[model samples]
Target: NVEATKTVVDLISEQMEKGFEIPSDKVITVESSGSSDNVAIINCCFGHRVNETMGRVVALLLSARKGRNIGIEIDPYRIKLTPASSKEVLEVIKSLRPEAVPELAERALLDTKLLQWKIIHSARKFGYLSKDLDLSRINLRKLVIKLKDTPIYREAVREIFVEKMDVEKASELISQFGKSIKIKVYDSLSPIGLASREHAFDLLMPGKPVEALLRIFRQRLEKEVTVFHCLNCKYTVKTPIRLIGDLRCPRCHSGLIACFNARRKLEEIPKKELHRIANLVLSHGKKAVLAMNTHGVGAENAARILSKYYENDDKFYLELMEAERRYIRTRGFWD
Candidate 1:
C-alpha cells in the first residue's frame, strides 16, 4: 500500500510536469489499500498539509466569492467541495497571485492552536527545553518570545512546510496556471470523486443553521428544567417546560411563580431576589418562564425579550433561539 501510494504521487507529479492529456472516457484514479497510507500520495504530490492548506484555500475562495461557509474535504485523490463544483475551485485558484501565497499561508496559521503546539513541541524536540519540564507552569507568551527566530522556531515552521504544506509547489502551480494546465469543470462528480466524498474528518468551514438543527434546538429547550418558586407559600419545585401546566403553585394555588435556572439552589437565592423574580413571572406569565428555561437565557435577558412586542408564540421562540445562538457563539470569549 505504501509503495502504491508513492507510485501514485510519482505518477501525478510526472503527469503535472509532462502535460499529459486525458482521454474522454478515462479518469485518473488514486487509491490506497490501507488507512495509514490513505493520504500519503496527496501529501507528497500536493501541498503536504491537507487540513491547513485546504482550509486556507477554501477560506480565501469563500471571501473572494462572498460565499457562505461550506464543507470541504480533501483526500489523496480529489477535493470534495459540498455545494460547490470543481470548476469554482479552479477559478478561485486562478485568481490568486503566486507571490501572495507564502504570506497568506503563514498568516492562516498565526492564530491557530496548531502553530502554538508545534512551536512548543519543536522547542522540546530540538533540546531547547528540558524533557522533564512541566508545560502547564510555563507561560506560553514568554516561551514564544524566547524561541522566536531560533533554530527551534525555524524547525517548527519547516515541519509545517514539509510534512503538512508545500508552499513552494503551491506557488509554482499558481505561476504555471494556463500554461501547462487547464481548468475543466464537470457537471457531475466522476466515480473517483464520488468515492473520495464518503469520508470527512472535520468541517473546514461552518454552515448556517437549517430547519432540522432548529428543531433539535427547540427540543433541547423543551426538555430543560426550570426552577419554580411560589411567592405566596415559599413552595419550590423543578419542572421541565414540556410538563409545565397552569403556571400555578400546586400547594397554594397561587399564580405568583418565579422561575430560576434548575442548577440554582433554593437556599442560595436571597428572599428579596425571589420576590423580584416572582413579580416578573406575575407580569409575563408562562411565556417568560419558558424563555428563562432556555439555554444561556438568564432572568434579565428573559425579561428584556419578553418586553418586546411579538405577534405570536412563534416570534417569541424565534427571538429566544437567536439569543441562545448569540450566547453559544460568544461563550468562549466570556471564559
Candidate 2:
C-alpha cells in the first residue's frame, strides 16, 4: 500500500509539473478495499490517523494535471470513527471552507456508494440513529451536523453531506432557516410555554426543512432562467443591454433606436446618414443666422464640429467653403 501510494503521488507530481491539464476521462480510478463481509467493521477497521494519512496521500496523487481521474476507494467502515481515519477526514473537512462542507459531504455520500456506506457506519458509531434505527432513513441534513464539537460526529456529518447535497443550495437554505432555529425569549406567565420553547431548541435546528425548501426552489428556477441575445452580432449574451438612447452602435456606429421599453431589440440605421444629420444640426448654431439670413450653419462652430466626422459630405463641405469665404471678406486686411 505504501509503494502504491508513493507511485500514485509521484505520477501526480510529474503530471502537475507539465501544467496540470489532465484528461479526466482517460485517467485511472484507484481505490482501497478490504476482505470482509461486515462493511461497518471493515470501514471502522482503519485507525483515524491512517485514514488521514491515506486521504492526504490520495489527495496528492490526484493533484497531478492528469490525476483528477485518480479515485480513492475505502470500505464502508474505514472512512468513519476509526482513530487515524476519522481524524484525517476531520482534518480534511476542517481545511475546507464552512460553506463548502455541506455540499461536499452530500456529493460524497450520494455519488460515491462506498463512501456513503462508510458515512452511515460512522453515523452509527456516533449514535445518530433515525427513529427507525436505520441510518438510511435519518434526515441527512440533521445527521451531518456538529453534535457540538466532537470529532466523531463532525467528520461523519461533513463527509456525508458534502457527498450528497449541492453546497451552494445547502448554504442558501441554511442561511434562510437558521433564524427559525433560535429560541425566542417570550415573557410568558405559563412555565409550560417556556418549557416548550426550550424543548424546541433541544429538538434541533431547521436544517432538514431548509434543504427541502431549497430543493423545491431550485426545481422552480431551473426552467425560468433564459438566455438573452444581442441582435446586431447574433451573439448569445446571457444578459443583453436594452437600447435606451437614439445612440450609435459602439461596434459599427449604426443608429440604434429602441422599438419599445419592454424589449431589448432595436432598429439600426446607416452610420453615414447619422453623422450627416448630427453635423447639420451642429452647424445651424446661433450666430450664423444673423450674419447670412440663410438656413446654414454658423461659420465658427460648424468648422469646429464638422471637421471631425464628416470630411467628405457635400452639405458639410459647402458649409466649410462658405465659412472660409466669410472669413476672408470680414478680415480688414488681405493675406
Best by TM-score: 1
> What is the alpha-carbon lDDT for the whole of candidate 2?
0.32
Cα lDDT listed for each candidate: 0.58, 0.32
Q: Against the hidden true structure, what lDDT does model 1 obtain? A: 0.58
Per-residue lDDT of model 1, residues 1-335, tens digit only: 45546544654455455443331112322222323212211111242244346446654564447456434444333443444444455556567787888777765555344566678778767777765565656665567667767888777767777876768766766566466544344434333333334322112212324455557667888888888888889888888878887788899899888887787666544456566677778898877777777767766677789889999767777788788765543331111
Model 1 segments more than 4 A misplaced: 1-55, 58-71, 82-88, 125-130, 136-152, 199-335
Over 175-237, each residue of candidate 2 has an lDDT whose tens digit, in order, gives 432243221111111222112223121223323353454444334323222222233443332
Q: Listing every candidate in turn, what is its Cα RMSD in Å to the true structure after a full C-alpha superposition?
A: 15.9, 32.0
Show where candidate 2 strays beyond 4 Å. 1-116, 130-132, 146-149, 154-335
